[model samples]
Target chain A: MKKLYGVPGGEVLELDYPAVADYLVQFLRRELAWRGFEKGLVAVSGGVDSATTLALAARALGPENVRALALPHAESSPESLADARLAAEAFGVPFEVIDITEMVEGYARLRPDMTPHRKGNVKARARMIVLFDLSVAYHALPLGTGNKTERLFGYFTWHGDDAPPINPLGDLYKTQVWGLAGELGVPEKIVQKPPTADLIPGQTDEEDLGLSYARADVILEHYLKGYPDRYVEGLGFSPAEIRRVKELVNKTHYKRHLPTVAVLSSTAINEFYLRPLDFRIELE
Target chain B: MVRHAIVQLAPEKGQIRRNLARLEAALAELAEDRPQVVVLPEAFPTGYFLQGGVRELALTAGELEEALTALYRRVWEGPLDLVIGFYEKDEREGAYYNAAAYFELGGRGLVHLHRKVFLPTYGVFDEERYLSRGGTVAAFDTRFGRAAILICEDFWHSITSTIAALDGAEVIYVPSASPARGFFGPRPANVERWRELAKSVAAEHGLYVVLASLVGSEAGKGMSGGSLVASPEGRLLAEAPVFEEAALVLDLDLDRLPPVRYDNPMLADLKSGLPLLLNDLKRVVEAL
Candidate 1:
C-alpha cells in the first residue's frame, strides 16, 4: 500500500524509503511464507534502480540469502560490470557476470534483417535468460528491476527486464529512485550517471524517446492527473511530442490490465476470470 | 527442439528435507527421456504457508545451495538444468526473501536468483508481512534455448512477462505455487490465468510460455497444479493434470514461431489513433 513517488502533476507526498523498504521486505517474506520461498535472486544492471533493489533486498534478506547476477552485452559499457560488482560487494552478496552478447548476436544473425527494436529485444531477453539460469542455480526468486516511470513511458523491453518473482520498485518514479538511492546509500556515481539502456552505441533512454525525463514526467502527470488534452497541449509542447506521448499511452495501455476477452455466453469466462485466481470461490 | 518436463509435486509443511527427496525421485522419472531441462513448482521444498512462525520453515542459504547443487548433479546424466524454488535467509542484510535459484549442470554455482516481484496483498496472500520483493528481471542461457523465469505472481503481472519476452526468452518458465479456490474449482483459476497470460504475452511478444505449478494440498491451502505450455500464438501445447502432482512434458520448435511484434504488427500499429479510442473508452466506462 506504500508508494515511493507521487503521481505526476499531483501534490507531491513525502515517502519514507526505509519504511517502504521494510514494508516491501515484509511483503515478500509474508508472500514467500505463503508461497514457501526463502532464497532470492537479484539481477544487477549496474544502474541506480537495480542497485537500490540489491541494497533493499540485502537489508530485508541477509546478504547470504541473496545472490546477485550481472548480465552484460558486448555493447554494454565496461564500467557497467564494475558498478554491478561494487553493488554486490556493498551488499556482500554472491555475484556472477554472464555475457550474453554471443547468444543475442546469434539470434540476430539468424534473422539477418532484424530491426533495431528486434535487436534491442534480443539483448533484453538474453539478459533475462541469464537471470533465470542463476535463479535456478541459487534456488532464489528472480528479482525485477523495472520502475513505474519506465513502465509508464513504455521504455522497457518485454519479458527481459520485466520478468521476476517480485518487483521491489514497480511503484517508484525515476526521481524517487534517486531519493531511495541516497537513502539506501547507493554509490553516487550510478545515481548521477546518465540513465542509458546501453542497448546500442551512444544511445540513452531519453534520446531514444526524444524527450527528457523532466518533460515526460510533467506530461505523464498531466495525463494521469485528469488534465484535459488541450490543457496539456497548451503547455508549449510540440505537436510531435504530444502525439508521441499520446501514442505511447494508448499502445502500451494493454500493459496495464489482464488481457480483455469479448464475452458472448450468458455465463461468460470473462466475468469469472476477472478476479485474480486466488480470489476465486471454492469448487464443489 | 528439446524435451522438457514441468514437475508438479506435493509439498508438505516443515518437510524441506523429505519433500526434496520426493523431488529427487520425480527427477529420476523425468530423466529417462534425457530431458534438457526440468521446471519445478514454486517453493517445492515447503508448501505455501502464510500463518505465523513460517519463517523457521525456510532453509538456510548454505543448505539450499548444497542440496540443490547435489540434486541437479545427481539426477541429470546429460546436459541438464533445474529451476527450483525455495526459501533462504540473507545473513548480512538480516532479512527474508522469496527466491528462485537455478542449478546449471556444471559448477556454475548459482547462475541467477530472483526475489519475488509482485507480492499479492489481497486474498489468501499476505506476502507483504514476510518477504522482501526483488527489483530486477532476470534471464538465462541454455543449450536448448534462451530462458527466463517469473515466480508465481510475476506471471500474472504484465510488465514482468513483457520484459522476459522482450529480453529474448524463447521459452519463459513460470514456477508457480498457487492455492486452489472453490469458486474456480474443478478448474484451477491459476491454470486459466496462466493460460490467458501466456496466450496474451506470447502472442504479443512471440515466445513460448511454460507454467509449472505445485499440486496437492499443503497446510490449509490446496495448490492448483496444472502445469501447462503455451506457444507464442497462445496455443496450448501441453498440460498436466490439476489437484494431483504430475510431470507435463512438452516439445517446442522455437524456430517455427513467427516474430511477435513484426509479424503480428498490432503493437506496431498502435501508433495511430488507438490512444484516443482507449482513453475515450476508459472515460465512458469509468463515468458510468
Candidate 2:
C-alpha cells in the first residue's frame, strides 16, 4: 500500500481559510479600488476553482457589484451550467448565460478538420473575448479562475482562461482550492465533482492528466519548493509519474512567463525601465 | 512534566480593558485543562504597531503591578504561571520599553521583567523612536524551571537565545505580534520561517522553546498566529491554527530533554572562547 498525498496517513497541506479569505478579500478590494475599479467580473464554470473565485469576488466587491457569466457550448455539461447558476444565485450576484456554440463554430468553420484540442482552444479564446467585452462594458476587472496545478501543467488555454488581470486562485493548488471552496460555502456537489476544463465532451482533468490531484499536489509542492525529483519520488510517488509531471512543468515553462525580448541596450526593459513595487523616490 | 498553554489572540487596538477581558475568557476556557503556564503574544495587552501612541498605551510599573494583582486574583485558582508581553513605562526614568513580564499565581505577583534588548526600526517597525533600549539579557528562576522571555524581534537575533541559554535558562518563551506575509503556496512563508527559527533555537540550546504569536488583522495588517511548541531536540510537538484565535495546551516532558549540550558541546565551545573574544574586542576598541 502506497501513501497518497493529503490522505489520512500522508502529509496534509492545509490553508488557514479564515485568514486566507480575509487577506484575499481585503487584497482584492484594496488593489482593485486602488486601480480605480469598483466592480469585478468572474467567469463561473460551475467548477470549484471558478466558483471559489466568484465567491471571493462577491465578498470583496459586494455581491451587488460582482457579476458572473456562464458561457456554455454544445459539448458543455448541463450540470456545470446548473452549478454555475446555483453559485451566482447563492452569492446574490446577477449572471447571464451566453451560448457560445455558434460563436465557436464560426471559428471551427474556418478549419473544418481541426482537432478537438484546437477546437477547445478556440472555444476558450472565444469565452475570453466575451468576458473581456463584458468587463469593458460593465467597467469591471476580469478575475482569473485558473489554479496553480493547471497553470503548472499548462492545462489551460493561453491568453484565454489565463489572461485575467487579477487572479485570486493562482497561488492555490487544486486540492487547496477544494478546501477553500468548502470554506467559502460552495455547493457540496460542485466541491466534490470531478474537475474539468469543459473544453470537450467527457473530458475530466484527472483522467487527462493521468494522476489524482491529491497525489500530484504533493509532488508539485515539493518540486516548487526546490525539492529534487528523487526526494519527491522518495515520498512514495512512482518515478514515471514524477518524470511526467516534471516534463509537463518544464515544457510549459514558456507559458508561465512573458515572451522574452532581445536586449540591445545597456539596460534591458524589464530589468531597469520598470520601477519595482517597493522602489521609493523619497525617503521618509 | 509541565502542561503549557499558548494563547494566540488578536488584541483590540488601544483597548486594554477589552484585550484583558478576552485574555480572561481564554484563561477560563483553559481552566479545565489546568495548564501550569500560559503564554500570550507580544504586546498582548496593547496592540502592535502603535506608532506615536506607545506612551499612551504603555503601562507604568505601578499600573502594571496593580493590574496583574487584580488579574491573578480573578483568574487563577492554584499554582499557575503566566508570561505576557506589553508596552512598559519606567516612571523613574520616564522612558518606554517593549517588555515581557512573568507572573506566578499567588506569589510575589510580578516576578520578572525582560525588556526587549533589540528595537527593530526598519520596514514596518519604528520602535526606536518610541522605545528606550534595555542594556542587559538575563534569565530568571520560574515555576517552570529556569525561563526567559524575548519579545518579537529580540528572538530573531540568535545571540539572544544563546545569552539566555548561557544564563542557565531551561526554556525560552518568544511572544510575537508578527504580521502575516508572503504567499508561496498554501501557507504563509513568514509562519514557516518562524517555525524554523523556533526549531533552531531549541536544537541549539537543548531546551524547550514556546512561541505564542498574535492572530487577526489590526489596521489592515494581518498577524499570522500559528503558535507552536518545540522540544529540546527541535521537534515540533504541537501547533495552533494560523490567522485565527486558538488556545493550544500541550504536556511537555521537561525531564526527557536530550543531552544535546553534552553531546554537541556548542554551548561549551562558546563559553570557552568567550574570554579571548572579549579581550580581542577590548583590544580592537583601544586601538581604534
Identify the candidate with maximal TM-score. Answer: 2
Give the per-residue lDDT digits (tens) of candidate 2, residues B248-284: 8998776765466677666678788877799886898
Q: Which stretches of candidate 2 lie over 4 Å from their true place?
A: A1-22, A25-54, A57-284, B258-260, B280-288
Q: State the lDDT at B143 in candidate 1.
A: 67
Residues A45-101, model 2: lDDT tens digits: 999998999899999989999999999998898988999999998888899999999
**Best-fitting candidate, measured by DockQ?**
2
**Native-contact fraction for each model?**
0.00, 0.00
Interface RMSD of 2: 11.4
- Name model 1 segments beyond 4 Å from true: A1-10, A230-243, A257-271, A277-284, B1-288
Candidate 2 share of real interface contacts? 0.00
- The global C-alpha lDDT for each of the candidates, from Candidate 1 onward, is 0.73, 0.84
lDDT of 1 at B260: 50
